[model samples]
Target: MDQTVSTVIDEDVCIGCGMCVKVCPVGTISMKEGRAAVTGKWSLNCGHCEAVCPVDAVRVMSLDKEQSAFGTFDADHRWLPHGEYDTVQLVRLMSSRRSCRNFKDEPVDRPLLEDLVKIGVTAPSGTNSQRWSFTILPTRHAVIGLAEKVGGFYLRLNRLAEKSWLRFLLRMVGKRDLEDYYHTYYEYVEEGLMEWKQKGRDRLFHGAHAAIVLGSKPGATLPKEDALLAAQNMLLAAHAMGLGTCLIGMAVEAMKRDRSIARFLGIPDKEQTFAIIALGLPDEEYQSTAGRKLVVPRYFEG
Candidate 1:
């Protein structure tokens, strides 16, 4: 990649503690006599050298100085004081989170939505590349418009899936890769969507006060994974704020397939919504947690 790493050592400020060498995940830093130096031919560019320096003697040329972590380890500005007790509380909070479909008509305040987005964007990303973007559909009308477009797209797909002759024609025309989506649309048309329509409710968004569309740039490495992490973070934070959240996988899929729906959401042509979270005050409540089958991990010891 022709990327050169510039490492500078302050001879006078260095205490020869060798802390930087020990903390470096990649073996890029080495002790030359009494001072530290970059001995490796290539750097992973993880920025551990600068983080471990006791006296700030090392500087990575490729790193942005403004974005670098500030403050000492003992008094790090980013450290939060919660520990095991907080972990238990967090677990309880997550266990109580429900995928709320029924929402009160009250709108989520702009300040709360802003706070949720702020927490969401702070989620960890590959190489610290926070490329996630969010589009907040705050009004009922806007959210309904998006839901209608996605529902229409699915309805059209359902027609082709329902007719035997049309399905055969579609397969012959080099479009036989939609079996899974076709099934989903078929079920939606048969029962799931009709139930909502009978109750005069929005089938897609479930009459949520607002919907947050989480997206990332097309072709980005780990885009789906990154967006999922951010969505989870937003969910937990929303629950904490006395709000409900539901991940709308159907709407996300429709957005990916239909460019018109994507444009309606104001998402860029090259960007895609990996996930959508509907947020609002809950219309229903649960007194206790429900039981479900658990899948335990298979651990390996080497």
Candidate 2:
């Protein structure tokens, strides 16, 4: 292999968990002394291996590239009556949001995350109950721990379905795969279930810089509409921060069923966990589209 193009795995940092080995696209890496050991000239084709090393053991040559994408958007020019530019800016923010699932390995900063949470508080709640709470889940270790427990439960249920004649019947009804996802489907439910499940969760929460679990008391004075409104506010604030968010559904559903997860979250039995979201800087880019069609419910427009 060319010394100019090389890879290094920090033995002390690596868990020797073999995730990267399974995820390697070219299959050039293996574990040695419970740590990742690169082998074969295929190691020469080892770019993918460096992408998902959760522990940062695998050093990629390009990881050091500077990322300074902050506050690049501008729209101060007035284009309409009243707060024209600012109104346009509001439209812009909404259109920019996407269900992001890709994220970098860097941990989200706590202070920044709190700022995002403050924006969440602005959302309206029924009768001012404001019954919403946000919990941030960071770190691969915590994600893996959650995935293992949840994934085990799902895998076991799936196996039970397979053993029964119902497995054959489910195909007809649309209960495809029976399991939540075949492999690497849910970072919190699927650890190494994908064909390359062993590789790593380089993209958990879609690599979002942070994660949020938003919920409200089961029967709080706040209306159900309040909960949803609050989540939308949080989402917009994250997007404006140059952060992408994936509104997680299935994984949170599993947590709802599993009291153990709720316990970890520290929610009292009286409260219910609602919308969950993952936050981070977006890796992929696309042009923006605005929902400015002006669909007024025309009450007899003269």
lDDT of each: 0.77, 0.63
Clashes of 2: 13
Q: List model 1 lDDT by residue over 71-100, tens digit each.
A: 211223343645625777888898888899
- Candidate 1 ranges with C-alpha deviation above 4 Å: 1-85, 169-184, 190-199, 299-302
Native-to-model Cα distance after best TM-score fit, residue 236 in candidate 1, in Å: 0.9
lDDT of 2: 0.63
Q: Where is the poorest 10-residue window by lDDT in model 2?
A: 63-72
Task: Give a tens-digit lDDT track for model 2, residues 1-302.
Answer: 12233567787888888988887755567877778886645343334566667776887563332221223333232225565457777977888887786766666666566666666765656544455766767654555555555565566655555454665577678886653343334343434345226665543345455677777765456545666787798788777776778876765676777777767767676667777787666777887564557776858768
Cα RMSD for candidates in order: 5.0, 24.2
For model 1, the local distance difference test gives 0.77
